[model samples]
Structures are given as structure tokens and as C-alpha cells.
Target chain A: MKKTLAAIALASAMMAFGLPAQAAEPIDPIEPVEVKNPALVELGKMLFFEPRLSRSGFISCNSCHNLATGGVDNLVTSIGDRWAQGPINSPTVLNSFGQIAQFWDGRAKTLAEQAAGPIANPLEMASTHEMAVKVISSIPGYGEYFKKAFGDSKVDIQRITDAMAEFERTLVTPNARFDKWLKGDKDALTAQELKGYNLFKSSGCTICHNGAQVGGQSFQKMGLVRPYQTTNTAEGVKAVSGRDQDRMSFKTPMLRNVELTYPYFHDGAVWTLEEAVAIMGDVQLGRRYMKEELADISAFLKTLTGDQPKIEYPVLPPSGPETPKFNPWAPAAK
Target chain B: MKKTLAAIALASAMMAFGLPAQAAEPIDPIEPVEVKNPALVELGKMLFFEPRLSRSGFISCNSCHNLATGGVDNLVTSIGDRWAQGPINSPTVLNSFGQIAQFWDGRAKTLAEQAAGPIANPLEMASTHEMAVKVISSIPGYGEYFKKAFGDSKVDIQRITDAMAEFERTLVTPNARFDKWLKGDKDALTAQELKGYNLFKSSGCTICHNGAQVGGQSFQKMGLVRPYQTTNTAEGVKAVSGRDQDRMSFKTPMLRNVELTYPYFHDGAVWTLEEAVAIMGDVQLGRRYMKEELADISAFLKTLTGDQPKIEYPVLPPSGPETPKFNPWAPAAK
Candidate 1:
């Protein structure tokens, strides 16, 4: 007990300052989030999967961030309204509540604000917020759902986004093998995985990539020690803040469920985790990892998958005769 | 007892002939189908909702025929691959197994045949069978699901379609109020609905519209009495038989959940059930009903909405590194 306590103290001291040894990982690890609003969550789940909210009426939020396929579209970028290509890779919604802000550019601070942007974006859902609200109000079933969720059937865009955020909060993954190991389960990780964890800490990869999500908590330049070349057009943080110096700087993406969300980075150019790890080492730390080290790091990263959201598929209510129908190729209503 | 026996014998004799009486309706109410293969059914459920089978990797079978909103997309016509407008409105997948054949033109003889058409159709999923099979084979997790479903993980398009058909069989909607009424529960339908049913029988509507599905047993010329005029260009049965004389001839669509699967008819021009009923009267029978009669028929159609399939959303497995990444806007690979 005394030795373990000393080790923990030393690890804490190491994490506080810029000191490195084979120290304990500074990651807090994820815990199962409590669903604070059940009614709101239910409404949100429907809205999340509700394609009727879009102009196409066929492209729901679930179209891009599918729950079955790891809360992501699994595309390099999403296919959007009228088959328009999204500007950048869509970040996973699995642990998005933990994200400091929404979107790659951080244009929207709250989930509600972020939610509103997509509906009006001509390249995204391609429906004005007013039209979306008008369509929802026309559906009689949604009125009752709204009333049950928010005390009144008077529908608005704010309630829609709020309900979506409520459900998103419960989507935080928990009980990963590493989290189990962190909680003192000795057999939770294999020998190589433990070795990988130690190496990850000692090699300074944990400096920017730490905390509950192991990376989402901070912003860093895409290429710190070395420059990265890519065909992706995104200028990252500069698009939001309009700061020339902020170019190439992006929010460190969360590593949770990284195994499921493939084709890594903002461009989603990298296919394998080993390649991503090696690239980060060379570009972020100016260190080239040996082949074996890359393999070990990959083994450690696999343990972060955790539990996926397991709720039953909600049976959506049928539409009314008066409800505006989805006609994808139809000319937009003026 | 003798009097009752005489009435039944007389009714049977009349049914055998072309004589129409309020004697007995030929409509056989639908029964709940028993699910035979539970494991295969489970696998089929996943495939039915799997979007990866599409070229865009976003449009799944559910995108057009959504289970959440009555097995049909309720669009005037479906939206398909890369925003292509579908040739016709999607049929209700609910209780489609009861149909004699699949598709509006009855080109595919079975559901499996129908299932395969959309995957490769340039207007639909726009993916070749070979590429789809390759993608599924690359995913290691699907191997287990396939093994459990077919006793082999050898992923093939045949297995994919078979699994989807198996799941679709379980989508049968039973326990409608009309079914109860047919089973001698006098109180199952309201007085107005009963009046509407009687009117429907008194008219020749019951001639083509009989049996378990209320209409899927035979094909008839669409504009029998009066030439139905519309802007839509579907030659119906002629497209298959290549017979010009078979123009506008179509299989009578099942009336089950007709309330949910609107806009009605091959053109999907009519929106309301009342409007459809009125059109059928004028075009098919050359008889326009009174306002009260239209209201009663509308009430009767509402009872066709049976207990919908209550199911949970399935969680699909992650992709392997070898799986082809979806990037529609990306420059074509050499």
C-alpha cells in the first residue's frame, strides 16, 4: 500500500510538471453518464433519427452519426443534401458532449447552436429552421411528444436541439478494459497492453492526449514539431476565430472508440491506428517509433472501445395527411 | 337451424357464380405469421437496416421504406442513390410477404429477387454485388453474425438478400380491428366503418380486392371503366410483358395500412384516403359516392392499421481496415 501510494504521488507530481519517467497515465478515464432527462432523451432519440426534420426528409441525423456503426457515418466526409459533400470529416457523436465546442471550426459553442447550423447549411440538411419547425408542427404525433418532453406542444427549434443534447449526454461510453484496469482490475489488460500504456506515458504521447476522453480536452496544432501535408481543405481553428496564427490548430480528437471510427485525422486520410500513432510520434514529438512500439500502442488503444449505447430502436409515429412529404429531387419551396 | 343452413348453402352457390349479394365477403383477414428461424431473422434484421451495402454508404433499405414510419417512406416517390428520384413511390414493406409477387410491375417473383434489384440499380443503391460482397467480407465482426445466421461466415450477396427476406417475413402486421371484425367480433369496428365495409362489398370493389391482403391476388387494367388521366409515366404491366395492350395494367395494391402508405396509387398523385376512394369510384366503377359514404370509407380504411412491429434498434459491428472507405467526392482511385 505504501509503495502504491508513493507511485501515485510521484505520477501526480510528474503530470503536474514537464517531467517524464515510466509514470502512471494522467487519463481520468470515462464513467457511465447519468441520463438526466428521460422524457427529453426519448424525444431526442426520435429527433436524432428523424429524417423528416431535413428538407430531403430521408437524411436524418442518424444518417451521418449512426448508432449501429459507432455514432459516425464511417465516411471520410458525410454525403449531404442533394448529394453534396460535407466540408470535413464528421466527428463521432458517441462522446460529443465531452467536446469543448461543436464542429471542427468551433462555430457553435453549445450543442443547440451547433444543431441549428446544420439545418440551414445548404450543403447539409438544406432546410431553413422555420421550414423545419413548420413541418414538425404539422405532425400531430410530434405535438404530443413535445408536450410530454417539455410541458407544452408548442414546438420550436430550441426544444429540438435541447432534447437532442439530453440524449447525447447519456451516450458517453464506460467500462473499457483500460478503465477496468484503472479501477484496479489486474486481469483487465494483457501484458503487451500494459507495456503499451507505460510506453505511451513515458514517450510523452500523454502530454496532449490525456483526461476522460484522452484527447478532447485541449487544442493543439496539427503539426507541432514537423509539418503535415494533406489534400483536406479545412483550415481548422482559423475558420472560427479568423486568426492567421491559429491555422492548422485543431481540437485533439477523443480516442474513445477510435477503433470503430476509422480513417483517422481531419482528412480521415490514415486507415490504420499504427500509422496514426507513428505519424503523431514523428510530427508531434519529432520521434520515430520502432515497429514494435507502434504495435504496442495500437493494442493499448483497442482497449478504449468501451460500451456502446444499447437502447432499443424507437418506433417513430406515422405522418399526417397534411404533413409535407419528402421529395429529394423536387425544387425547393420558396 | 334449417333456415341458417339454407342461407349458407344459398350464399355458397351465389359465391360460386358471378352473383353479388351482401352474402359473404371474399376477403380473408390476415393472421399473425409465426417466425420460424429466430437466429436468421436476427441477422436479417441487421441487413435490412445495413446502409453499407449502398455505394454512397448512407442510404439503407430503411431510407426509402422506413420501419419507424409505417414500412413506407410516405414520399410521392422514393429518393435513391446519389439523390436520384425513384421511378415510383415505395410500397409499404408492412405485410408485403402476403403479396403474390414483389414490386409494382410484379417483375420480381419473390422478395429475395426484389431485395437484390435495389442494391445494384444505378437509381437505387448503385453498388455492384461484387463490391458489396467484398466490403462485407472485409469486416471481421460480420463473420460471426453470418456464421450464427447461416452456419458459415462466407459472406455472399445471396446470404445478404436471404437474411433480409427472412427479417422482412417477420414484419407482418397482424391484429387489426378489421381482422377482429372478420373473426366475428361485432364490436371491433365502429358503426360507420361497418357501414363503409358493407358499401365496399355492395360495390364491385370486392371483386379484384379480396383474399388475405384485400387486393394483392390479381392484376387488372388500372383505368377499367374510364381512362385514368395523369402526368406520371408508368406503363405498369407492359414494362414486364412488353405487351402494349397491357398498358396501365397493375396488380391491385394491398389495402392494409393504406392509411399510412400515402400518397396513393402508382402515380402517388392522391394524398388523402378520401380522395383515393373517390378517384377509384369515378375511374374504376363510374360511380361517385355521397359525402357521407366517403367519410364512412375513410373511417373503415383507418382500421386497417394493425399492431406495428415493435422492435429495438440493432447495433452493427465495426469495419475492418481492409474495408473500402466511403468517399464519394474523392477523386477516383486508379
Candidate 2:
């Protein structure tokens, strides 16, 4: 009995460290990815918090990707221009730097492209590129900052996109329990969670969900192994790329903070992480997880959450003589 | 010339009193509408600012309708539910009580309906009605308050909606330069603005834009006289209501803070208020205005802005055992 207990403890410890209880391939340590431009990231942080970039003169990027939360407003879809329903689910920006593409349809190839899309998207920033330039240029401090940041006082789309992308890149989730376990923490997971992790790998989830980003490196057919009904599939890449086969294929999302970023799935169909895990297993993995397995998997997935990145508000530039308190309806002095 | 000036002064003074400046009949003032329960409004205010209502355990209504900037985020659309675009513009909650209906599509018939929409919206609060009740009820202070407000500790949807609606009703835009002039402040508007106001009425803008809310009481074809092409028109309305007549017909929109609400129109096609006014005259009113007239009208519209409403955050209730800081992905204890 003493020898059996010792063996069980050894197996448990090994499993907690992301090692197989029996002999198997050892997992590698996750390398910390460094952000390229700290200054641009700092600048982007300020810009993200600045409401002046919006037409309403009140909303900032933080309004949606609220830092205090899991970097998402927990709504089915966001409200925007004229209080209409946005076409897609808002993805968390926490581990977005790991994403190969941005947006549900993956219309943007780079973070810079993604950054510019929202600033000029009528439903998002509601400001035209010309208006954004004009608004930024009107602020003397911003003009100077632009010159210092991008070698020009002339505010343009490229600098704005670069700055925002730089800021977003810094929004990485910190070391999660899973990462700690991978780094050899022997108490990071439990026996049941270890079983769930094994199931996750054997179930073929690792086929698409392997990488530092976990799942953002590629696109896959959501219902490849099984059939699932989705309205978005009908309106797929045709609406964006005007192509076929791109049909039913979406950018695989990063699962870094998946526990907090719900309702899950592209259309926000699954509200609970357990339901999502179960559905993905059934529909994508071609198997149905048992109740115990589902619960354990959910517990394991929860270990993926990490500390949120801290962001500071930007100091607004002095309003030009033409601007009045930045009030949209303030009557121009006759 | 003296007699002509006297007549002009008399006409301007009449206009100040919310009366028509020209031959149009004077319209009645929209009566002050009363909320169903004033105490509920007080409660709603508390709930609105409390981050505990959110799934991630942070973010309140004030997170978007920031009181510091005219009760709007100033973004064309707010980010929510994982940083996705909110479908419509975040209309300033200021003076929203005067709106005939809530939301750009007139989806919510009352403030209560509007209040409930966001809380349940997957992208906004990402909470269900039951979840909201459970969370609120878990708070001891909220239980007592709900009992006091609704005669029950078991808070229901109606009570929550009523409280929020009551709070929203109090968010009226106070006196602005326009209001002061209406109260007989002779110098409230300049000569150019007065001319612009005259043009505003004479050009028949008063036909659709006349009301306490300035324009919320009606919905008219975007281009009544001349057809204006908008890429988002057909699909936009279709997304909200499947009705065909609803095509190109959006909420007339309140022009109270027109100057602050930028990238004008439903699709945010017009970048500036001046351009919007110009387009309205050409397409809706079927008349053309000179650059000078557009400038003056734009100036007159500015006077409609009022002081920002004061908002106080509520003290959190301490009843429920503080759920360990909502770490959705934290590993379970061994």
C-alpha cells in the first residue's frame, strides 16, 4: 500500500507538470514573446483611451475592451452607429497578437490592417480617414507627437494604424496556470484535469489548437468531422473576399482567455464554456464528451486565463480655437 | 430700416420661445413625461454604475455612457463582447427620455425595454435575466433596496427594467445656449445664427425635425425628395426588421448634440455636421444651400449642447461571499 501510494503521487505530480503519467514525449517550455515597439505600444495605449478619435467625442477603445474585465463587453454583439447590431462577435484583444488574422471573417491579414479597419469603419469609429486626420491634426500636441513618433507632423492612416497595432501587441495575457504547469509546476492541475488534457490531445483538438497562441495560426472548417447548422456559413467569405470554399471556414480564434471570452463560438451561440467544449468535441472532434470529462475539461480550460494587461488613459490634446469644449452640439459663436 | 429691425427682433424673440419664426403654426411643447417608479430610477442608477452586474465582474453602464462627455462614448459605435463592433451608434442618454422610441430602429418601445436589451445583449452585459437577478440578489444591500423599491427581495425583470428606466429619465440635458435664447435671452444667438435659424425653418427642415426631442418623434425616408445612394441602406434595415418599407428609413434621430455626434447619418456616411446639413437639404428637403448658410446652420446646431449630467457611482453591496475575483480560468484548488 505504501508503494502504491508513492506511485500514485509520482504519477499525479508528473501529470500536473504536463507530463504523461506513463512514459511519453515531454512538453516544451513556452517562450515569452517580446513586443517590438514599446514606445508605439505606449502611444497606442494613449490613443486607445482617447475619445477624441470618435465622432461622438466620448467613446475610446477601452469602452469595449474594458481592461477590468476579460477584454470584452459581455454582450451577444456590440452596439455601434445608430445602435444597430454588429455583424460579428467581438474577439478579446488579450492574446490577439498571436492571431494570424483579425475579425470573425479574417478580412484583415495584419494587426495594422485590423487597427485601421475599425478607426475608419463607419459602424465603429464612425470617422472617415479624412476626418480622423483632420481631428488629429487640429490638436497641436498630437501633431507634434505624430512628428516625433512617425517623423511627420502630418497625421496619416499608416502612423495611426502602426501606433494602434503596437499598443495591441503589448496586450498579451501573462503566464497562465497551464503555462506554469508546462514550466514544471507540479501542483498546477489535478488528476481529473490531467485526464481532460489527455482527452483534449487524443481527441484531435491539438490538430488546430497547438501553438503559443493556442489556436490563432490557422483556419479550419468548424464542422469538418460532423455537421452543424450556422447562418454565418451562408454569408461567409463571399461578403468579404467574394470567394468560395472560404465558405464555412473561419479564422481559428486564440483560446488564451477563452474562459472569460463567452458566449463562445463565432456567432456567440454557446454561452457556457462547458457547453462550448462539449459542442466542439461532438461537432469538430466527432465524439461526445462524458459529463465528468466535460466538467474536467472545463476546469482545465479555466487554467488558461492569465493576468490582464494594464493600460493607461492618454492625455487629450488642447482643443483648437475652432473646437469648443469638444462639444458636438455647442453652437459655433455667431 | 428701424421698423424692419424691430420686426426682425420680434420674430427672433418669438422663435426663442419655441414658436415658429415664420408662417408655420406654433406647435405645443412636449409635456414632461413621468416615469412609472421614481425610486426604481434611483435604484437603476446604482445598478448602472455597479460593475458587479457584468460577467467579468467589471464594467457598468457608465463605462459607455460616460457622464464626463455628454452621456456617450463618442465612438461611432461602442466596443463590447470581446471588442466587436456594436451594431449602432451609442446615442447620448441625455434627453433620451424625450425619444418616442429607443434604439435607432425603434426596437424598444419604452425606456424599460431599452434598459433590458443591453443587460441581456450577449455583446454588452453578456448576462441573462436570471443571472442578473441572481447576482443582484446575492448582494444584501440590493436585496433590501429591491424590497424597498419593489416590495420584494427577489428582484424580477420588470423591477430591474423599471429602475433603469426611471434612472434614464432623469438624465435630461439641461439648459443650453439654445434653451437660454428660448427663455428670452436676446443675445443668445448671433445675427448669422438667427439667419441660419430662419433658413432652417424656411427651408422646411422644421417639417420633420420639429419636436421636444428635436427629431426623435418620426421616421422619414432618408432622401424624401432626391434619392441619395447609401451602400448600407437596404441590408441595414433588413438586418433589423425584415419589412421592405423600412428600407432607407431610419429613426429621424435627435439633433440635440448634432455637432458632437460625428460621422453623421445611420451609416455614418457624412463626416461633418455641416456636410450632413447640406445633404439633408439636398436629398430630404429637395433644396440647395450656399456654403454660408451651411456654416450658419452648423453654428446654430452647436447651441443645442448642454452641460454634462452628474453621475455618482454606487457603493457595492457586501452580502455575498466575494466570489474569488472572477478568474474564469484559474485552476481549481488541489
The candidate that achieves the highest DockQ relative to the unseen native structure: 1
A156-220 in candidate 1: lDDT tens per residue? Answer: 88998888888887888898998888876768989788677777777777787788888777778
DockQ of each: 0.59, 0.04
Interface RMSD of each: 1.6, 10.3
Per-residue alpha-carbon lDDT of model 2 for A1-334, expressed as tens digits? 2332454566568768966532442222234458665666666776776666765554456655655446665445554443335556667777787677887777888888887776666566555667666777776657666666666776777787788778777777767877777766758878766666666666677678767777877877777778767664334444577777666677787777777777667776666777888889888888878787788777777777776664433434434544423343333334
> What TM-score does chain A of each model score against the native chain A?
0.91, 0.85
User: In order, what lDDT does every prediction score?
Assistant: 0.81, 0.65
State the lDDT of candidate 2 residue by residue for B186-247, as single tens digits. 58878877666666766677677776667878767777788887655334344468887776
DockQ of 2: 0.04
TM-score of chain B of each: 0.91, 0.83
DockQ of 1: 0.59
lDDT of 1 by residue, B200-252 (tens): 76666778778878887777888889999988798998999999998998888
